[model samples]
Target: MNKRNFLVTGASLAAVALLSTACSTTGGASGDPAAQRAAIDSAVESSLARLFQENSNAKELVASAKGVLVFPNFVSAGFIVGGASGTGALRKGGKSTAHFRMTEASVGLLAGAQSQGVFILFMTQEALNSFEASRGWTAGVDGSITFVNVGAGVNVSTQTAQQPIIGFALTNGGLMGNLSLNGSKISPLTFN
Candidate 1:
C-alpha cells in the first residue's frame, strides 16, 4: 500500500476506536443511574471549586447566571477525524435539576486526546428556559454559546459576562484554550 493511503487507514481506525470509547463511557448509562448521578455531582462540585479558585471572576458569573450546566470530564480524541462526548448536570439554584449528555463530531486536521471540565452558564432566563424545554439542544443551532477563555491571570470581560449564554473549559493545569461549542448536540438523559 502507498504511504499516504496507509497513514489514512491507520488514522481512520484510531478515530473509530476513540469514538466508540467515548460513547461507551460518557455518562455511564450502562451502570446504576443513582451512582452515575452521584459521580457526576461529585465531579461537578470539585470542578466548580477549582474554577472559582483559578478565576475569581467565575464566581460572580456563576452567581448571577440563571443556571449552570457542568461537564466535569469531557473527553475529546482525534487523529484526523475526531469526536467528543461528555455527560453533565444542569443546576438551578445550586441544585441538580436534570442531567444531559453532549456529543460532537468533526473532520479536520486534528490529533490528540484531552479530558477537561466544561461549564455553560445561562445568563438569561429565556435562554435557560429554551434549553430546558427543548427535546435536544444543539450549541450553535439551538442557541449560541460564547466560550470564554479564562486562563490564569486572564479576567473575563464585562461584555462576555453580559452575554445570554457563556461557556468555559477547565483543565487540571488551568483553563483550556480555544474551545468551540458549535455543532455540539446536548440531549436530556433519562436513566433507567
Candidate 2:
C-alpha cells in the first residue's frame, strides 16, 4: 500500500477506537451521588405513575410498598439471549441496614448480558428475615415479589399481594455477558 494510504487507514482506526471507548464510558460516574439518587427517585416516580395509570395492580403495588429501592442498574446474563434491567426501589424505612442478591441460570438460545436492571428490595423486618434466613428464593416461588418490565405494564394488587414487597423497574444496559467472562459485577447498595 502507498505511504499516504497507510497513514489514512491508521488515523481511521484510531478514530474508531476513540469513539468506541467514549461510548463504553457513557454511563460512568452516572453523575454526582446525590444527583443520581434524585434522578433515581424521579425516574421511579414517573415510571410507577405510568405503571399505575396503565395497571391497577401497579397502584396497589405502590400502595403496598413501605419503602422502595430503585437500583436503576441490575446486571444479568446467559449466553445468546441477554438484556440489561434498570428501574426503581420501594421499601418501608425502619431497618438499621438491608442486604439482598440474586443469581440465576437459564437455558434455550440464551446469551449475552442484562447489564442494567432495578432491584426493589422491600425494606421490612418480615421480608428481610425471610430473605436473610432462606438460602435461595426464586422470582415467583417463595415470595410475592413482582418485577416490572420496562415496557410490559403489569403489577399485583395490594389486596392480592400477601406481603409488602420491594419493586424495581430497570431501563438501560441490555448488552452484557457474564462477570467472570466479561468482567461484569453486581453493584452494592447506596444509602441516603
Compare the candidates by TM-score and give the number of the best one.
1
Could you tell me which residue pairs clash in candidate 1? none
Query: Least lDDT summed over 10 consecutive residues: which range in candidate 1?
Result: 21-30
The TM-scores of all predictions, comma-separated, are 0.90, 0.44
Q: What do the candidate models score in CA lDDT, each in turn?
A: 0.87, 0.43
Give residue 127's error in model 2 in angstroms.
0.4
lDDT of candidate 2 over 1-192, digit per residue (tens): 999878655654554443344322213436565554455555445545554454465455545555454443344443332333332333344222332333333334643444444435453557655544555444555555544433344433344354445444433432121222122122333533
lDDT tens string, model 1, 43-99? Answer: 889889999888888888999999999998888888888888888899999999898
